[model samples]
Target: MPISPLRAEAPPMRVGLTPVFLDDQVSFLSRWRAWLEKKLERQVIFVQRGSYREIVELLLSGKLDFAWLCGYPYVRYRRQLKLVAVPLWRGRPLYRSYLIVPADDDQSRSLADLRGKVFAYSDPDSNSGYLYPQYLLTMQGENPSLFFARSFFTWAHRKVVEAVGVGLADGGAVDGYVWETLSETHPRLTAATRIIGRSGDLGYPPFVARADIPEAQLHLFRSALLEMATEPMGMELLESMRLDGFITGRPALYDEIARMAVRVGRL
Candidate 1:
């Protein structure tokens, strides 16, 4: 018989992530990494960043092959990134920004009501958490920086909810998907806050690859995500994520976000 040689393991695929949607999901991320490695036949490394700025910086510097990024940042850097896949929520790759306040506060009915109040922002690059709210004020001829008496970065959507829920902030903006997910996973906490306003549907944050990433690696990673709804283990993962599935998303899906960015002069 002819002798066979051992094959070497490929280098790890570095993926960037922030705590925008995933606040403290260590176990789920571990399982997800295993699934991706199995599908791609390559080791995977998940890089955690405290903010989207770190993720975007690493990705742009070629230290990261891919990252899940908010639509606002994605649109701002669209020319430098390639869309990998978009997660489906309630059967669509769309979500909204939620304006929330304490449940007992019935005086607040809209964004205008929250002016001059303390606010919590998930991240400056966050579409639903920061950009949308800024655009809201900008379109109305209001200066966002001056509209709020004070604002702070919670860095995570869940934390934003906690801030408003505990009266730490009079109001806050958050990703509607994260808010909805919390309503399911931690009902008591979500119950403490009430949604006072909702923004127009925007592109769901998307997994993206560096513009120069090899096509083979990009395809494999995208396949691993898009097929998650079909396999048994994948279904379990999807259920835990409270997502429907992933789809090959078009760049145009974020056009509205880009337009909003232009309006806010963030472009």
Candidate 2:
């Protein structure tokens, strides 16, 4: 009788994430992890943190194998990170920063109109949530620090919307994709706010691996993301996440974000 070969499983890979995407989708993460483990034939552990800074620190310290990071951080630390994939939103690797105000505030048309009002920023390290808005203020000859009556970081995009929705903030900066997605998942929260201004399209947040991670592991995860649109279960997940798919986006895709970072000079 021929002996059956043992199915070898690779060591677990740690993926870091902030609440920017997960929000209340706890079960979704479990299912997603199951899919990835099946694809890689290896254990996959997700490291969830409340803030991007925590995840970034873990990733840079070699504790995390991969992370889905905003364009701002990915560009700022490009040398230490390897771009693996960029999410597709609306069928393209692009999204925008939305400056939002309460639904009843029809008088405010742009960021300029919200001057000296309390503002909520998702995260200081966030592109759409902080850097782009800061750059816009700098370019317009205003100091971001002094432009608002007060400003605070919520550390998560969904929280930014929540802050503005309940009038805890007069205005807020948020990821366009997150806002639109919540419109479907949590319409009442979104209905309480309105997008008063939108930034020029920017690179969607990207999936990245630590530069020193094993090449085989990196390629496997990247391929899994890129191939997500091809299978039924993957497609369902994509739709649930409101993403079209993932692509091997170029570094130039984040040039605009890098420019914003440079202009803000806060990094």
Candidate 3:
């Protein structure tokens, strides 16, 4: 007798989120998860991790069916991920990088004036924090490594603010949204820093699904997100995350980020 062939099993949908909420406000994430679970009608689990880099790694490894990732990381992994949605900041789908210095420092007014000064970068992989600022510096005919006497990556926007506050570095580029959020909620840090300049706006971070996820399911996820800001439960979650709404997005939205990375040879 011939042996029967076995059928393949479909994998369950798995969603992953960065610790953006946890880092800024954990209470909000808890409420968000509860709301997401009810809205999706599925068991939604929140993966706790140390950094955004780790979240990216987990998603790339097929552990997550979908994820929310920063713009640069999403651009870097666009081949393996599908752009789903991105949040609008201050009524725009894009945000900028802020070159901040001590509130009392009046010596440096322009990028060129920072020559030989110490600088802090949120992270090497950060789009607004590192890449865009570097691009802006290049446009001004300055290389960060050559312009600054020393530089350091603090790995978090708050740390960048803290570093500047304590006079550890002369100044640094921080995500404008993060700066705004911190300034509004955490007055101590923002009080110590002042924005001296702003880089050109770039696409904000996005929600993405793995490339192989079923199209039907992706559509459902998108619909769910699009309605999140309206539902009472979801509205509370959005407020917790300091977001107004989620908007539809395209992969091409992040192409500039990839091009910048390639130009800087950091991709």
Candidate number with greatest lDDT: 1
Error (Å) of candidate 2 at residue 222 is 0.7
Native-referenced Cα lDDT, model 2: 0.88
Off-target runs (Cα >4 Å) in candidate 3 are 1-14, 19-22
Error of 2 at 162 (Å): 1.0
- Model 1 per-residue lDDT tens digits across residues 139-165: 989999999999999989999999999
Report lDDT per candidate.
0.91, 0.88, 0.76
Clashes of 1: 0
Candidate 3 lDDT score relative to the true structure = 0.76
Candidate 1 error regions (>4 Å):
1-7
Candidate 3 lDDT over residue span 1-267, tens digit each: 111232234234466765332255666656666666566666566665556777787888878878877788888888998888888767777877888988778787866777788999887767877887787777676775788899998878778888988889889888888888887788899889888898666788888888887898788778888898788877766766677888997777788888878877678
Worst 10 residues of 2 by lDDT: 1-10
Residue 69 in model 2: lDDT: 91
For model 3, state the Cα shift of residue 194 in Å: 1.0
Clashing pairs in 1: none
TM-score of each: 0.96, 0.95, 0.88
Pitting candidate 2 against candidate 3, the one with the higher TM-score is 2
Query: Which 10-residue span in candidate 3 carries the lowest summed lDDT?
Result: 1-10
Predictions ranked by lDDT, top down?
1, 2, 3
